[model samples]
Target: MFDVVVCKKKQEAENIYSFELTLPEQGYLPKFQAGAHIDVEVRPGLIRQYSLCNPAGKTDRYLIAVLNDPASRGGSVGMIEQVLEGQTIRISKPRNLFPLDENTGFTLLLAGGVGITPIIAMAEQLQQLGRDFELHYCGRSRTSMAFIDRLRHSPFAAKVILHCDDGDAKQKLNLDTVFGATPEDSHLYICGPAGFMDYVLGQATDSGWPEARLHREYFSAPDVASADTAGDEEAESFTLRLARSGKELKVAADQSVANVLLDNGIEIPISCEQGICGTCLTSVLEGIPDHRDYFMTAKEHALNNQFTPCCSRSKSSVLVIDL
Candidate 1:
């Protein structure tokens, strides 16, 4: 972890603010790639991940934007209400779960609302590399969109298309037009609300776009029924075996594996307990995991070698994990 000072805080859009963080000495920090995010210690025991919105190669400062979400579980609220300019905060090194595939022949970038944070970095990287790419930014309205003027005056302005729900029908996003035909070597990267992402993913799938070519990052996990409400078949108690210590623990139906381990004095670093973040991802030594996380792709889940313990449980009666 590093202590970075919040150099500036500016309101970007309606309830959205961008923070510029820099080292105390104003020196270069660790280099990060596009789609990389840092874990900010919002408050004691409250760490939240925010995407790096600044250019990847620029190490002088790191930029992140946070939307004061109504449904936020304290992350955004704390950032907007408590954090102030010139305040020093603790943050983890950059981690990239949503990496950009620069080798693709063509790239399609899609952003909705605050999701534009990572998409902007991707566009900057693509422009720097002289890669062929187009960006489509969608929002509820012009006033609700962040960095509109910046994008409009950017060097790659011509490659960008704006879509507003409250604007003219012609300016609204048409998935059919955005995705006419799937190019063999083209890749699509999407980051947005769960509903927006689901709609885009569904449309892309229906348009014959292979899952391999479609990438996405979700700010929060979609609402899903809990284990208790999943019927007795899925809510059965399970046993967990720690590989290194050879210790065993019982995971009750009403409890999560993370809580069970924590109660036993076994610490597993966890950020987003909802499983949207991959911080608590653990390896499975022997049993299959009933993967309940949005962090890993479907193919990764099918491998059954790893799972996020924060929200995922084991399918096998006794599962061995690499603690």
Candidate 2:
């Protein structure tokens, strides 16, 4: 289900714009956690998920920031250019796979570029609860950083660190210094571009940060050049058995399950067909799956009971799926 709302634009920084959304009829919206995101319907068939940046547990109005990217697939373009203030749009309910765990000894919030949206919200919540936390916000330039003014004036400004590459090189974010001295019971959260995420996560791992202590959410899928090459190999025909329907369908390696299903008159709800979103996730009744999605954690992969058909394939010759 979707809720129709009227949005008013609030400029945050440079090309970054925050929209305060309220129901067209004006009433309390659904309550959401710090890391929750809502899927906004930008156009007839185009939808994009954006993190709710407002304080956690706040139901007054949902706030989302969007950076005007010319390279976007019409979602950001539509929101920044087409959807003006006072215009109405539809958005999905909040969904959160990334959330804050308050039981940690300390919290490290690392954000790159527009990734600050969710991390900022997490910082605000942590501050309100009087928790031990620090936020490191990085951008190419000070002018490019969003919410800079707001954070500077906030009561928690002392807990915030700003790093800009255009500034002094020594002042830039030093992953080694940050991760090297991390407490054993601390939890780290990161969000950013593929390269930025890789660098932070790779160094954190080298610093002995356990898998359980590290959490990340990607606005885009990690750069998988090798995976793309492997996925494009010559077609290897396989069978897809629908456990519920007792039907079997042939799936060519060159064709994704979603495409094959669509051709066979079987429709499945899907978004971010690149496997970044979990909208097309389906249960695996039998057989092993080649997990190609970034939506699931390592623990979920170990269960082997679900897979995203939009991009993931079968490891076995046949995959029995619960359709």
Candidate 3:
């Protein structure tokens, strides 16, 4: 974790806050492509991933935004509500898991609430490169949206569609019509709340859009949102073995495998801690992981038994994790 001072702050919405951090300019700040996010060290041993909303041009510092979710785990609440203006926080170098495809002809961008962060970054990049793309941003209300002014002022501003449920009677995001009418070569990107994301993805899949063409990002482990999903309703028992430590940990019916690993002092690089970012991805030598993350490429999980440790569980009794 690197120390970065909060250079500036702004309130984008009622609880949506933006922060610009000042990092040392001497060394190279990791060069991140569009759609990258950085993990900020809030307090000792606590890190949260915020998407880089700034466009690429200068290599000065990183700009991030955080929305205070009242129902969220304390991490986001602390970052947004409790963090002082000038204080510094440890930050991980930028990582790009949601990179734009180089050959994208025309892209469809969908964002719900704060999920607009990275999608806005992609719009900035697309504007610079003169790419053909359309962005659909859905929010609870106009007053609740972040970065709306910046987006409206962009050169490619006409390409953006902002949907506010409170103001518009036709408030819902019509993902099916959006995907159905889009060009065959179009690639789709989505980010947002779990219900919004699931609806968009499920509709897209049900509409017959190719899986490769649809992409999405999550801020937490999928199971957290999908706890009521099929199979998750019933807790199952499993055992995990740490290869390096030669210790076996039992997963209780009530606890996730991640909590068990953490209780044992295993250093798994986790950002979302909910299996959203693939940072805590662990190698699966055995057992079928109940893959519950948006991180995996269909081929990557099936071709090799890879799983995100943050939200996955084992179907087999003995699951060995390579930390």
Which one is best on TM-score?
1
Task: Supply every candidate's count of residue pairs whose N, Cα or C atoms clash at under 3 angstroms.
Answer: 0, 0, 1
Writing each residue's lDDT as its tens digit, candidate 1 over 1-323 gives 88999999999999999999999995998999999999999998999999999999999999999999999999999999999999999999999999999998999999999999999999999999999999999999999999999899999999999999999999999989888843567899999887899889899989888889989998998765445335335577899999999999999988899999999999999998887889999999899898888888888989999999888887899999998
lDDT of 3 by residue, 147-243 (tens): 9889889998899888888875566667666777799888989888877887888888787778899888877544344553244557688888877
Assess every candidate by TM-score: 0.96, 0.93, 0.90
When sorted by lDDT, best at the front, the candidate numbers are 1, 2, 3
Off by over 4 Å in 2: 227-229
Candidate lDDT scores, in order, read 0.92, 0.85, 0.80
Angstrom error of the Cα, residue 292, model 1: value is 0.9
Q: What is the lDDT of candidate 2?
A: 0.85
**lDDT at residue 170 of model 1 (Cα atoms):** 96
TM-score between model 1 and native: 0.96
Q: Is candidate 1 or 3 superior in lDDT?
A: 1
| lDDT of each residue in 1-323, candidate 2, tens digit only | 56665567977878888899888785788888889899898888888888999898888799999988766778788888888888878888898878899777799999999999999999998988889988999999988889898789888999888999898977699988887666778999988776798788888888888888889887877656444336657446789999989999998868899898999889998767766768889999998888878778778888999999888888889999998
lDDT of 1 at 323: 84
